[model samples]
Target: MVFPERFSNLPEYAFPRLRKLLDVHQAGGDPINMSIGEPRHPFPEFIGRAISEALEGFGRYPPNEGGEDLRAAIVAWIARRYGVHLNADQHILALNGTREGLFNAALALGVEEKARQKPAVLMPNPFYQVYAVASLAINAEPIYVPATAETGDLPDYVALPAALLDRVTIAYLCSPANPQGAVATEAYWRDLIALAERHDFRIFADECYSEIYRNTPPVGALQVAHDMGADPDRVVVFHSLSKRSNLPGLRSGFAASGSGNIAAMKQLKNYTGAPLPLPLQAAAALAWRDEAHVEENRAIYRRKYQMADEIFGNVAGYQPLEAGFFLWLPVENDEAAALKLWREAGVRCLPGSYLSRAVAGQAIGQDRLRVALVAEEQELQRGLLRLHGCLYQ
Candidate 1:
């Protein structure tokens, strides 16, 4: 049998591995799932009407990049949100979801070799899985940089040895990071941009959770790049409607960068991309233009964040999340704590070790559990309380 050895070494994905560990034991009480980050808030009321009006266009092939209205809406939103001006034609390309762009952009931009060695893709140790897979697909060495508590939950790419940095072609960064909710400050972005310029690598900013923060908006990579007058090609950002508009099923997102980067991505997409159905794209366009729904969504997440703080506030190692909804709560052992919570209370949460890899002898995510606060307030409260009782006490 022929098989691709490149992916054979990959661990079984997070959810399936979780099911194997916990499904054999009956949930001790009414099950409350806090494992997945899928948003539970209501999508905007206008989506149905918008989709209905555009239904006829589904009969025709949609544009590979995006229709004019959708592109304009994205550009306008960027201006309003980040205070950066961008040309719709040169700077943006619609994606089925940020995941697609995040994966494909590497293929489009990563060269076969850099500085006489295999190209390297830098990523946080406990990162979104797609980043590693993208690097593997291209045979690039996926360098897992530790983004631990000591590093403020963001990768310190600048500290890498200059020789390794010089071989790098891309670095993936997520702010309001998944699992851990720490955000990158403007100074953080500025330093990173400078580092990328020095090393000659492009920055892939995954800002999917940008809109789900409490209080001040997180600083964006594009804005910082613009402020520093960095080459426009230095940073490419991918954002999603999933977290912002509570539209995970919509599968709508966009990537923005210098024209050269966008053009390269567009060329690749022209051959193999699955453009969103015209009807869905219309709904997404409306979703992007309207800030009212996004604000309401943020308000819902804000209240949840408060509930989480109150429930786990006194627990010894609970880090108050700055943005994003996941609670990366500390534990003596992640897998055992998850099992105890599942067997004693019907609370389902993921063991953080599954999201990270071991380097040397220590796994970065071994002492934590990633709990999603995506349920309604009352249900979320019950889950968190049960988790607190079962794990903390």
Candidate 2:
């Protein structure tokens, strides 16, 4: 049996490789899992009631794009939050999760045969694995742009050569970026939007982590695109209830883009996408409409961030995160640091290199490790202390 060679060269998903590295070690103390990004906050109290009330709808297959009420709620939320107006019917599509939308958007919008060259999908070096897979799945060349300290932890797509930009079909950007916790500034978004407009490629903004931040909310890609008067189709934003409402189990999110792109995505989804369960959709509608629970969730993450600062602020090579829950700490070697933390401190983390690819003579993430701050206050404090003691002391 022959298999596609494209997938054959892909590295093992980060978690399994982490398991192989630390599973053999005897933990030194009570285990504190700082590896995965699953939130430990309480979801809204009404979610259970909402799900119970909508349970009957589960018997019916959900609409592929999303129900009217759910889509409208998402639209209203976007308008209120990002100041970007979207027509629910024309520009919004509900997703099982942002991952689904992020991956499928590549298939739905990625144009491989435009003039001659194989289309390129540009992504940050240490990026969400889905972006690379999506690009490869569409038979496009995946370009890993470095988003390390040298680049302010955001990929500099604007700086790429004009020739490469011309062949670019889509650029995947994560603000409050995964692992690094770097939020893109308004100026960053403006430059990127202009570049996308000039090059005629779509910007896939993975804003799933937008809600969990410190100080001001991070500027959104769609909002910047609108402000710049770029073609509406040039930017697509994916958001989720996973981080905002602390409802990862709900598997609820939405994609907002130009009418044409949303229509194309909806068409593809009709044949291949799995809609959020009807009951979950009903719960998600309420989740999107309510911001009180979201505020509380953000407050918890803010407190955790403070705790991290208290613990690691003075440590050498520690860069405090501006937003998001992960800490990208510079270490001698990511894998070595991770193994030491697991065995000596009983705290598990992901090695940064696992999340990035080598590019242009540099492994951008080679000397860092990503620590998730998704545990409850007490556990997170203990984990942070353990990490500091293990690594710094």
> How accurate locally is residue 20 in candidate 1, as Cα lDDT from 0 to 100?
100
* Candidate 1 residue lDDT tens string, 91-112: 9999999999999999899999
Clashes of each: 0, 0
The clash tally of candidate 2 reads: 0
Q: What C-alpha lDDT does candidate 2 achieve relative to the native structure? A: 0.91
- Tens digits of per-residue lDDT, candidate 2, 183-202, equal 98999999988888888899
State the lDDT at 132 in candidate 1: 90
List ranges where model 1 is wrong by over 4 Å.
none
Worst 10 residues of 2 by lDDT: 357-366
TM-score of each: 0.99, 0.98
Q: All candidates' lDDT scores?
A: 0.93, 0.91
